[model samples]
Target: PWLPLEDDRVRRLVEARGPKEWPKLAVAFNETLDEKDQRTSKHIRDRWTNHLDPNVNRDPFTVAEIEIIRGAQRRMPNEWTKIAALLPGRTDTQVTNFWTNTIKKLARRALK
Candidate 1:
């Protein structure tokens, strides 16, 4: 389920130049792959930023983090990215998923 062999190189490139060069980096990466395995720039960037970036926190959310997320969501409804900005180590996808899957469900149950 993981293709981590090229992750180190991807991380180095992104760290050196940032995500702005992701398209060019993707092209270069595709050049080294077989045609059947070629990936789109968006796919490459999303994979690195969302899953492979070392800065991303895979740990369980703490109580404080959940409170922060709740407060931020109330201020900026579906704006996951803005909410995520207030919580270090959390990606927008992670924030959105946690809110939709955990927090919202708990709230619904509490109200019932």
Candidate 2:
């Protein structure tokens, strides 16, 4: 459920009121998209903080990036922001989801 935070309407609302108004903005944005409002303020804030930057590209992780994430997981556990910082160009949500869905599944399979 990715929001295009860069959308003009969404961006304007966010710029006008900041992250605190995300719930209202989400509804408005969803309405414009003709989509249901399934996102919460936290979801909007996370996208705004991590993925909304025009300079950042959303690319899949490389093997090296995965290894870095593994090491960071051992050191920082569930500290997603710290783990994301270790992997340049990645976001906390991306790192966290990767760990939860990919790494954890691999670990579980290996344990069997």
Candidate 3:
């Protein structure tokens, strides 16, 4: 059974404190809901992160920045952390997704 987490109780638990409180909150969620649908600390933390304003945490990559990411990726393929380090303000997931979604798609289109 899918337990929807958009309820007021879940929202209260998420907004109650910072990341440090996620583990405790996850436990609380288990107690409040069902033990079978247990939410991990990471799940709680991700929910908090997802709720944050995207503009505050992420920005669109400039052309020069994309070039930098491409160059770094060629040098160290699949090394997301290294690629992210080369591009300041970008997370590993951002870099990897850009490579997979944007860059790779561009390449495929060019080849076709």
Candidate 4:
């Protein structure tokens, strides 16, 4: 019998597989993030914060995820260091990780 991979098990496999496999597993992760809380979708709420809901993007993150990240940062214009100061439970280093990645991804898009 072909037992489809269990949810947590499949995601764990994906994590070990790395972002190179993100496209293949993105939907699963998004669904898990949605149902994880079973109240409202974390992915949806995050998209709201990222301004990419259906009222916004009509889909979850995509190759367009980078664009959505770029747009949200523009709407803030913070140093991210500053953003960390304003946010609870998140460090500047964390924000900086994303900030740097955002810039690199945007640069790649611009190069195309």
Top TM-score hit: 1
lDDT by residue for model 1 (7-100), tens:
7767777787787777898887788789988777887788887888888998989999999988888889989999999988899999989988
Better TM-score candidate (2, 4): 2
Output the better candidate (1/3) by TM-score.
Answer: 1
**Cα TM-score per model:** 0.81, 0.58, 0.58, 0.31
Per-residue alpha-carbon lDDT of candidate 2 for residues 36-73, written as tens digits (9 for 90 to 100): 54555666676676656454547778989989998888
- lDDT tens digits by residue: candidate 3, 42-102: 7766655544424224667889988998788788888988888877666777777777898
lDDT of candidate model 4 versus the reference? 0.47
Local distance difference test, each candidate? 0.84, 0.72, 0.68, 0.47
For model 1 the local lDDT of residue 99 reads 87
**Considering TM-score, where higher is better, how would the candidates rank from best to worst?**
1, 2, 3, 4
lDDT for predicted candidate 1 compared with the true structure: 0.84
Itemize residue pairs with steric clashes in candidate 4.
53-56
Cα displacement (angstroms), candidate 3, residue 5, comes to 7.9
lDDT of 4 at 22: 38
What residue pairs are clashing in model 2? none
Q: Model 4 over residues 1-112: C-alpha lDDT tens digits? A: 2123444444364456642443445454456545543322333233223432122223323454445445656777756655655544444445566678767998999999
Model 4 residue runs over 4 Å out of place are 1-78
lDDT for position 23 in model 3: 76
For candidate 2, give the lDDT of residue 54.
55
